[model samples]
Target chain A: MIVKDAVCPFCGCLCDDIEVEVEEGRVVAVTNACELGTTKFMGEKRMKNPILRVGDEWKDITYDEAVKYAADMLLAAERPLLYGWSGTHGEAQCVGVHMAELIHGVIDNTSSVCHGPSILAIQEVGHPGCTLGVVKNRADLVIYWGSNPIDAHPRHLSRYTRYAEGFFLENAFRDRKVIVVDVRKTESANIADEFIKIRPGGDYAVLSALRAIVQGKADTIPRTVAGVTREQLVRVANLCKSAKFGAVYFGLGLTMTQGKYKNIRNAIELVSELSRHTKFTISAMRGHYNVYGSNEVNTWMTGYPFGIDFSRGIAFYNPGETTAVDILARKECDAALIVGSDPAAHFPRKCLEHLAEIPVVQLDPYPNATTAFCNVQIPVAVTGIDAEGTAYRMDGVPIRTRRVLSSDYLSDEEVLARMYALMQEARER
Target chain B: MKVTLAMKPAAKWFIPIEAESIVPKNFLSGTDLRVWRGNRELRLDEVFSVSVEGDADRAEDVEVVLSGDTFRLKRVGEYLDAGKITVLGGIGMHCGNFMSGGTIEIHGNADGWLGREMAGGTIVCRGDAADYCASGYRGGRKGMKGGTVEVFGRAGDFLAESLAGGTVIVHGDAGDMTGAEMRGGTLVVHGDCSRPAANMKDGSCYVYGTARGMIPTFKKIGTVQHDGRTLIRFSGDLANRGKGNLFVKGYEYLD
Candidate 1:
């Protein structure tokens, strides 16, 4: 059986043009997807059974028992934290938020650790943004700052920025000017028309200088800022100013550094400043397929975006304070309910120590670092493979994820709904 | 009049409660105020135990004490012209958003957008504050145009971003972008700042401790003495031809 126009739930691109060949309820071949997507669709490292951590040993448990155990732990605790909804569908996230509210817990997503700084910056200096279609259609000057989409988002350039032909531009690659700014020459930089090598943690300085040059404040800027000369900065500013339409896509390189949100703020402000001269927009290179969806859903349900806390019987938000990393490191929660993310592997040592000490319930399709550490582990069907739901792209475009295969296991939404129901029933009792 | 609203411990608010309507100015006549609970409009009495002790017509004359955790309450004191609102626990997002006049004292930590687009007010968070405090919303250019926000504890990133006019003081360490894209404002951090001021058009940021990162757009203008303490003053966010001033305490020279 061949599945057409299936959305790949691997990365934030949400490439919906994939064709999957399924045989015996398993994906055999995937076409039009990157290597990462192929690996995800193939169910590599997929966990089969629900496991429970007992006396430092993993024991397979039935789905019903897993749900009961998860609910029990959540209800028993004074303060339970629900973290990570970026990998699941919007439906599951809605249920998860409800669960968090009922339990008076802290609910946060992966963005708290990643593009959260970008969100903060966007909230500060409003984003001059455009959809991927707009970038493909009108953008003539494309700048990739502190991000290597070649290795991360392999199909991004060919599908949207560099090679994709739009209505106004025939030969997109030839018609557009590509600029890459990073600490080192990356794979994406190798193919760019201009590559500006910046010193580590110098993104803010470089971005500010570029903004100064664009705003005609060059007199105040030093000849050499962040190792980039005045001539290079001026040339880049001129290109941005002269372009009919410009788009900048930044990644963790900007958010993870010392400046964090400041780097992104400078970049966004620069793009906003460029808009004064020409049409310019900016977007964060969101990593997960539904990470943007998690934020969108959380924003609609709660006034705040992410890092929400409901422990006080109301939804509260604070990034550094309420984020998963900080909350876990602080060891504030008595119990934790994690969904669709593996913080045990990704978080720092201090955070992992707190997570290990707590009673954790993890709901995911695969058994990873979190599964091994969690007290109760529930196996759910893989999104876009054995389950279908709504997912948002990196640019905040909602797309329907199609299921190409069947699975006996429950979906993430079903599991969360069941958990919510179980918790409600237990509370009443 | 002094109004005290305490949340019942058993009450778990799944739907966001918009408490902007429960300001002191609206309760002078002791009329039952209605707030939105999800899609339904419910009276304040249904969720909170409302009691009015004193009598007053103006918002500033009224004292409102909101006890318990109100982290789920959205827009706590939005669009307040005058009043004194005190939250015993943490507050949700948009706590004092668009407040022209008022005093919101949060005894506990605060969520993001603590004083979003606040035109005038005094917001004091005894605990830490989340991101976007005294900052603008998405697509907005002007942030806390005029106000005073003091966080006794740490503050998250993007503190006072795009601040048109305001005063923000943090006693504890601040995350990145202390005063970013600030057109006008006065931001003082007694603790360490990750990355102080970037792309600021006009503003003044004084750091009593260390500033982790510095933008090349700022030129060091030599040290100055303030309150018997040595401080290094720098000018320019030269990116936007901004005449912003950044003063760091016990500053070391950086080439």
Candidate 2:
């Protein structure tokens, strides 16, 4: 058995350093996998059947025919849009971007909807962040604001946040103070010694109150402020001011909430403020394993994260203009090529409605909601299952994902390269 | 009417949409509306000429039935203008997100951003809503305006952050930061809450129960009862010159 360290491409808590036992061209077993990771590793998706539109009904076609058909479609499209690269690797993303540039297409990813807000905040105000390894080792005070990693990133607690025994925090959770601030009582909140439940959309007020208390302007709080009492507000603020090393792990709570960017900005500002007194940082609880990697690649390729438009062959950043939800809801793009995402099962109703109106293409290793709606569907090999590539963990740590089985299909990188070649061929033709 | 949409035997399976009044005019039947999973992006405007096609209705109220594993619908109103859309089962995130007009009632739970950055619409959830109800997308500042979201059950959190306008009523308990940096709007909570109004510049939060904590910035004026509900009034998120009122009811029960 050949054991290799790889990142678990599950949720956002991209737990790298996972050891996979490969035996006889098969993944005999995997170590350090949580419930979510186990599910992702074991979940075997069925291959999709190739289909070409003859008149109204789509007929199954060969893989060669499908690839040729997809290439032809991209070459023929006047204004093509390529989207969805959250689950793949940076190399694949690079290839996809080049394909978009070759075709002059609008290339986007799932972050346009998921963490696009966080990326925007990073651009506006530099993100005060560190790797999860640093957090696992140095952080003594861990605050989960509006995010429950237990349900989302199942192994986050045991692997990185609380239980993981690091160099500095030898006692791990015993030496740490866990504070969970949320609206309802979550599984994580239940275990937290200090659980502050603010009313929904009340984070901004709570953060400000904490900031005020940290600044020591006021002592006693009013009887009511954003549903939280003055006393409890002080407790949370004091936690931030007094902690030697603190980290705030926020999720869709800060971004998608009422404040949106303002909420994130405030949270980031709060962390910045706390850092003045102590060492504190904030990290967005990204969803997909490579979401942050996607952001990095997107930023690297176009100097923008998500919601980028390349109509002028130059990247333009506009959340309201180019974000997947906004772009689709407004009916902006003329054609779209989706890779490894299920927008039909993931996007908002408005965006999905607009998507139903366009010419769509899908490429993936399995059957999904977005592929079911494509004008052309191309089946590709699973990245970590049937193909090998490099992917970044949520913490920005690069880890190689190894293929565990054999497959005749191409990788996402290969597919994008083929598309790029086809686009070039089409341009020449 | 029972509309059963299964995965067509194609390489990719998109959503099978069958509406009562609206139908696509001139596109391939299974090829028009498409869906995919894994790492792919689909542009909304380029797939089909008409996204949704349904028979125009005059019943003053119409219920569109959607059945699938997880369906994400965007620009739902462009296809058919109806009084109400009731989702019987679990829906993907942003069920009625960015809806300009109409009422959407989700019978089952929705993922996240139930009515994200909605300009106008009413979304009522009988089940639990995941995260950021009637709020903005990940980074955009503007949130729901001219809309109402009433969650009968529990909510995830960030109930109404950066809300410009509208009313969100969570009948059950709320999560954290009920009204974070709210500019204008109203959040009504009926159960015990932690903090109802956080950094709210302007807005009214009426908590029918006692709050666990309150920011020191707000000044409690007194208590008032309106429409058979006792409300504890508070003013000033003072940090941002906010005159927003945070009202906590059932103060007597809160030792």
Candidate 1 chain A lDDT trough over 10 residues, lowest sum:
A326-335
Please tell me the TM-score of chain A for candidate 2.
Answer: 0.94
For model 1, the superposed segments whose C-alpha errors exceed 4 Å read B1-195, B201-203, B206-213, B219-236, B240-243, B247-255
**Model 1 lDDT, residue B246, Cα:** 87
Q: Per-candidate DockQ versus the true complex?
A: 0.22, 0.09
Tens-digit lDDT track for model 1 on B6-47? 875433243346677866688787758887543346778887
Q: Write the per-residue lDDT of candidate 2 for residues A205-292, one digit (tens) a residue.
A: 6676666667674553445556778878777788768778998898887777765665677788778878889999898888887777
Number of the top DockQ candidate: 1
Q: Give the residue spans of candidate 2 off by over 4 A.
A: A22-28, A53-58, A219-221, B1-255
Q: How accurate is candidate 2 locally (lDDT)?
A: 0.69
Which interface RMSD values do the candidates have, in the order shown? 7.4, 9.1
Q: Give the docking tier of candidate 2.
A: incorrect
